[model samples]
Target: MGERRGRRGREGSAVGLEKYWASDPMDVLRVRQDFVLADVDTGSAPGFEGKKREAEKSLAVGAGILAGLQEQLFAGHQMGDDPRRILLVLQAMDTAGKGGIVKHVMSAVDPQGVQLATFKKPTEEELAHDFLWRIRKEVPEPGMIGVFDRSHYEDVLIGRVRELAPPEEIERRYDAINEFEAELAASGTTIIKVMLHISMDEQRSRLLKRLERRDKHWKFNPGDIDERMLAPKYREAYQVVFDRTTTPYAPWYVVPADHKWYARLAVQHLLIDALEGMKLDWPLADYDIEEQKARLATG
Candidate 1:
């Protein structure tokens, strides 16, 4: 919006903005847990100085590039190469805009090239195996972008806060998660982990609005109030998660969620960044292009 700072790439693309931010939003919001939850500005949009309408316009352009890149990646997979895939792991508190992200940022891409997984309570069958058993089953196939609405981190986040598992087992999960993610990375998966940070007051306001409207009541979970009561504990759990699992293979970006537009824009930028880094190219045609053109003309 201001003086563009980055080298231009594809036409009408926001991927170049990665170079403009004084610090990339991904790095600015990364979680090393050097600071506590209170230290983050939930309403602040780092590395962006545009209005909602401008951000939305940029998002549309970015989405087009993302869709094109995704198609190339999918095409490569179809041509038999094990192309890298993106697994966007989204973790956040309730009403922190995860649905908005899936609906807005992700909707920019071809649906056939995307996989969405939402994790709820563990099923009785799911409980019998390792915590990651169900998660492993949903990892995106090559060339498709996978979105984990809430992920294995839940076993540590909610499991620790709610005391669903013993303290020692909870501690063990941190290392287990690190190892599991490393495996994913080694297997051609590029993980972009995000934790949407929203203030307590904002969450309270959103929850209240959900309760106030008859239509929105369907989205309300009474259990959310129980979790809200233990917000401080949950924050502490998240800190431990960042400290233990933010790795070079998979780092966590903490997006401020009080402004839904900023959150959506930031996530789209992150996805674009990941895809751009893949350096995908369209698959080569097995048949001669000139011959095929002549055949089509004759037909």
Candidate 2:
């Protein structure tokens, strides 16, 4: 589906996102010293002033720009020499729409250029290694976009809330993660860490809907209710994560995710912004185009 976009997508920036966005998301959605998860209105769309209709329009426009930019990055990797890549780290509670972002926003680019990794329970082998051992193996190669469905932060989030590890060991992983990401950034990985923030009430509604529909029965997990019971602790764990891991090199953006459309659009803009910052150009042809054209004509 996305392959055709590479052939005719626009090269210019999609300005509607910039125009409708009230300010840089970093200034609004990024964690601040005074930021509190409880204070965030889950339904609110921070940094964007546009309504759903306008946002839908902006999303369509951005898709073209995103597709074209991805083409350039992929070209640099497969056909030319380029070292830059992107790692979009997504952390959220169940049903926060991580899969939706992957489907709706990332579908604009060719699948070959996108690498997706979902981190679930560690096998006995993975458990024997350090927490990041498996994660490091999934890092995207040059000129590709990498996504983490649920990432290393789960160690601190679920780990702390459930007391899976000793408190001291959990503490150590925080610094370990920071150093690991800094190293990746130095090696030319553009890291975008995002937390999809959803209200407990909204979560309840979604879960109820899943129960009502036969099709959604497969998605419902009774364990989710058990997890929901510990929402307060999870929120506190997330707060600690923000306090320690949010840094200049790999900052976190807590996207309000109650509205699935807004969350998708916001993440699309974030990806576009990260790619735009790269300032990459389409790789020039290695062969002489004129010579090839002349040879074809003579034949």
Highest TM-score among the candidates is held by which one? 2
Each model's Cα RMSD: 3.8, 3.9
Error of 1 at 211 (Å): 1.4
Each model's lDDT: 0.85, 0.87
TM-scores for every candidate against the unseen true structure: 0.90, 0.91
Alpha carbon lDDT at 292, candidate 2:
100
Local accuracy of candidate 1 as per-residue lDDT tens digits, 1-299:
11222344445344544433344576677777475666888999898877687777767766776777778778888875855899999999999999999999889788999999999999999999999999999999998899999999999999998899999999899999999999999999999999998998999999999999999999999999998899899889988888889898998998998999889889988887787777777677777899999999999
Q: Write the per-residue lDDT of candidate 2 for residues 30-139, one digit (tens) a residue.
A: 78776677888889998787889888887898898898888888888777778889999999988899999999999988999999999998889998999999999999
Q: What value does the lDDT take at residue 174 in candidate 2? A: 100
Worst 10-residue lDDT window, candidate 1: 1-10
Misplaced by over 4 Å in model 1 are 1-23, 33-35, 288-299
Off by over 4 Å in 2: 1-15, 294-299
